[model samples]
Target: MPVLVAVVLVVAGCAAAATRLRVAAPVLLVVVGALAGLVPGVPLVEVEPDWVLLGVLPPLLYSAAVAMPATSFRRELRTISGLSVTLVVVSSLLLGLFFSAALGLDLGWAVALGAIVSPTDAVATAIARRAGVPARVLTLLEGESLLNDATALVLLRSAVAGAGAAVSVGAVALDFVLAVAFAVVIGVVVGRTMLAVRARVADPTVTTLLSFTVPFLAALPAEAVDASGLVAAVVAGLVTGHRAPRVLTPRDRVSDALSWRTVELALEGAVFLVMGLQLEALVVDVRAQHGSLHLVLGVAAVGLALTVAVRAAYVVLLLRSARRRVRHSAERSAWLDEVEQRVERRVQHLPADGDTRAVRRVERFRARVRQARHDLDYVLDERLGPREGVVIVWAGMRGAISLAAAQTLPASTPDRPVLVLVAFTLAGGSLLLQGLTLPALARRLARPATADDRASRTRARMHALLDEVAAREGQDAPRVQVLRAQRTALLDALEEGALDPDAVGHALDVLDAEESGLELRGEGLRTS
Candidate 1:
């Protein structure tokens, strides 16, 4: 009954947020969960730690990874690597040291706490997306959140071992490397195998079922081999996502997308709500235990503070350095542009009008300049920028994973209740404080799209759609191409300034409806 109610609340919260309120869905779900907890006969929702790490993490990670833009992810690989591995390790060590001093925890236990809370949650990334953050920035955050788990878990195992025995830095590094390598190999092999299987299966229903199991297929085997299941899931998702465009039919793609979106929406809401509803019970449990409330709260406050501080410093330094490099390249491009323009003009106006060599050289130089400028802009846009840096730094809200990690600690561990309570506090506090404000921050930081930029993008999209339509080779191909041609002509006129922006937008909207009808008819005819 509670589960049913929770699902209803999740659905309701989303509908209300979409149609009426400006509030975040996660926030609303959390509030609903808390109020429901106060109701008579409502049972407490408890999520097991192993269930989270084993069952929940895989699909969520896979879905996010698959949805992520591969091009943007590759471009920001360096940033992602720095945040996932280097930042996780650095934050773990620093916070571990802090916990040891402030909470009087053993070094190993303190480090365990550090590892638990180091990675930013997927919920935070989703919130950022809802807040209208730039796509590239969201990619970087998503990439970081996906990979950081493997690193944190490796560190966590080492920390747990250190509780009773000595563990070396080299050992930890070796474990991390091996875990990632094994997970990669497993993921690729499984992904390819699945692709081969998918190619043989024509039924979308069966294929959808196969696709749903990919995350587990990737995760379980890797985990069985003592590798990082999370990494395996991510890699599998990436490969599957990359293949989806080529392998899956339009209907399959549509169905798959809807299925994953539904799953993601439910899991995200339930996870957040469950955490909120459990907060009061956890707090009470902590108070009933033989620990100081001040101590538990203090550790949480200090740990969250340190986590935010480290993240800020890291973002600032990385963004500044990236910006500097981009600016330098942009300056060089400007200089090259000037020289190229001058040379082109000189060649064009020369007395020897048929100086082919000079003309060719000028054109080549112009191409070179254009390429350099494009690269510079792409780097700043897709990799790092000051405005995006500000938002990313603040989007480090923790989620269910932190609580699960804390709960996974051994029963023999000291101050277990207090530790769990502190972890819960940090995760909840971060969510409420960061998740609630992220949308407003993104709005403030987002650069408004210019009219020219918007128009150019729309025109380019129309051209791409036309090309896709033309590529079709069936009984309906000619008709589709002709219809697409009309759309293309409309866009071309809009681009040429024959139509106003408003008129162009209206035309495109009509074309969208027309295209949907064509696609539906095509599907129906094929099925018939």
Candidate 2:
């Protein structure tokens, strides 16, 4: 425990430095861990893969899902589904074939390797976000990464169970369909039930405890029934997050945010650090066993290359299809607008009484046509183009999930050392190679944020904060009224240009903190 504490302290320090330098935190932590492992008297850390899957994964995934904007997620559902499920399955198959042929591995082991490395890591996605990737592309990548793990894991289980034997494809497909359906139902049921429970509890501490517990509560049962726990956790998060604005008090949200961020940083750092330590140990193990380092490295390199290539190809094809559809929609929309205008002009020329009804009818038709065009544009806008697609493709760098999945592979698997080495090396190489260049690529691909975009984001945040303040009911209402009045005065000053925008923002934050503190005390009083 003492050594563990020391390791965490060191990793935390490194993470802080990485953030300050604008480098990827996970990559830096991994490098630090590798060095730590190399130092004499520094014991190597070994975390059970099951610990990660059950304990670390649920909360990390839940936090991310809750943090996601529920409306945007729903809006981009189709695109997210394709990238998360369809692309993951496709990439896994292609990589499995490549690895099996290239490395002379059994088909099942090859498929397992493919599944192990397929999903884009959340750590890599975070690095890409720092690189200035567009919000839309980032959302798609995040959504895809969060859900793809379950898909890859499902495929992996089948491959591992088959042990290189041919499995029935139709049966696998049926299982996938059923697993998703069951997972969604279970997730929704758990999430909604938890929301009600939290609402009644009223005690902020108990509410926070429920927030932490809900992920595992939702996931483990689903996994027990052979459904996708990843999907369950994500669904639960989405449902809870959508309700959180109303369900959780300002104090609860603030406390939960701080606690979760701490948990995320610690777990993320520990995962990568342990991986680096494992990599160090793995290198020594392979050398002692007289295994060919060159062969393992060669296969890992090939596997990484194939993973990126498959993703890039899929992105290119998807972009082309989306572009063609957008062009078709625009053309049809132009024709519709022209016809609508012609009808209105003809209606205007008719006799007064007869044309009045016709004019109103034409107006209604035009409104519907306008709405149709808007709907089409909304759908098109969510689809990835070449630039966004490139960002998503590069953001496919691996992290904790890949390493954890590698460790879960059964001991009897052929070339076990080789597989483990490749998994570790592939993950590290992705971070060092892809993580290093992702920011540069994202910057090149990203469009600059427009003024309207900035304003929209600002407006949305203000409304959300104000809505929370409004929703804080009970014994604290009197104190809340004063805070609200002060907030109004700040807004008035900002509107009059008497106060700087930044100053008003800072003041509002301070006021929000004060309000939250009061609410927290009130909740305590109520509990007593």
Worst lDDT 10-window in candidate 2: 493-502
TM-score of 2: 0.81
lDDT of 2 by residue, 1-528 (tens): 897798779778988899887789888988888877888887867888889988888888988888776645764687788888888888888888887997788888888888898887887668876776665677788788779898888888888876656778787787888888998999899999998888777667778877888889988999999998888998999898767655556566666777888888988888888887877789988877756699788888988888888888888877887788778877887787787688778766777767567778776776566555554654454456677887878888888898899889998988777788888889889988988888888887766664246546556656565566556544456766756566775554343333324335555557768878876577322322
Model 1 lDDT per residue over 1-528, tens place: 767775766666664674466666776666666777777787777778778887888898999888765555665688899999999999999999998898789999999999999988877776776776765677788899989987888888889998999988898888889999999999888887897798678676788788889999999999899999999999999887666655665456566777888887777666767777777777777788854588887788888999999999999988887877777876777787787678767766866667778678776766555545545556644456778888988988777788878888999999888888888888777877887788899888886674246456756755665556556434555554555555666544433333333334455446555555677777322322
lDDT of 1 at 424: 83
Clashes of each: 0, 0
The residue ranges of model 2 lying beyond 4 angstroms of the native Cα positions read 328-383, 449-528
Model 1 C-alpha RMSD vs. true structure (Å) is 6.9
Q: Report, for every candidate in turn, its global Cα lDDT versus the true structure.
A: 0.76, 0.78
**Candidate 1 clashing pairs, residues 3+ apart or interchain:** none
